[model samples]
Target: MKAAEIRSKTVDQLNDDLASLKKEQFNLRFQKATGQLEKTARVKQVRKDIARIKTIAAEKSAGKKA
Candidate 1:
């Protein structure tokens, strides 16, 4: 998801997305451990997405405090 889209979401939604992404990241790690992952690059992409979502959430929270 794009930063703009993430920014539009409520905090609850972002938390949900973050949870789902973390679960996916865990599964990807397991797949990698078993040597079953098709594309290793997907792990990196998912990590970046998680970071982006967190960054947007933090920005929104900080804006609210100002």
Candidate 2:
């Protein structure tokens, strides 16, 4: 998802998305450990996406506080 798309979502929605992404990240790591991962690039992608969601979420929260 793009930053713009993430920004459009409410904080609750962002939190939900973050939770699901984290779960996926965990599953991806498990797959890698088991040597069953097909697309290794997915690990990197999920990491970046989690970071993106976090960055945007923080920005939103800070904006609200300020």
Candidate 3:
């Protein structure tokens, strides 16, 4: 997902996306461990997406506080 797309989401939406991404990350790790992972690159992509969501969420929270 693009940063601009992520930034457009509300905090609640971001949290939901974060949760699903984390779940996918876990499943990807499991697949890797079982030697069944087809797209190893997806793990990296999910990780980056998670980070992006987190950064955006933090910025939103900080903005609210300020």
The candidate that achieves the highest TM-score relative to the unseen native structure: 3
The predicted structure with the larger TM-score, 2 or 3, is 3
Misplaced by over 4 Å in model 2 are none
The prediction achieving the highest lDDT against the true structure is 3
Ten-residue stretch with the least lDDT total in model 3 = 2-11
What residue runs in model 1 are displaced by over 4 Å at the alpha carbon?
none
Ranking by TM-score: 3, 2, 1
Residue 30 of model 1: what lDDT?
A: 100
The alpha-carbon lDDT assigned to residue 21 of candidate 1 equals: 97
In order, the Cα lDDT scores of the candidates are: 0.94, 0.93, 0.98
lDDT of 3: 0.98
- Return the TM-score for each candidate structure: 0.93, 0.96, 0.99
Candidate 3 lDDT by residue in tens digits, 1-66 = 999999999999999999999999999999999999999999999999999999999999999999
- Which of 2 and 3 is ahead in lDDT? 3
> Residue 3 deviation, candidate 3, in Å?
0.7
Task: Kindly list the per-residue Cα lDDT of model 1 for residues 1-66, writing each as its tens digit.
Answer: 788888889999999999999999999999999999999999999999999999988988999999
Cα lDDT of candidate 1 equals 0.94
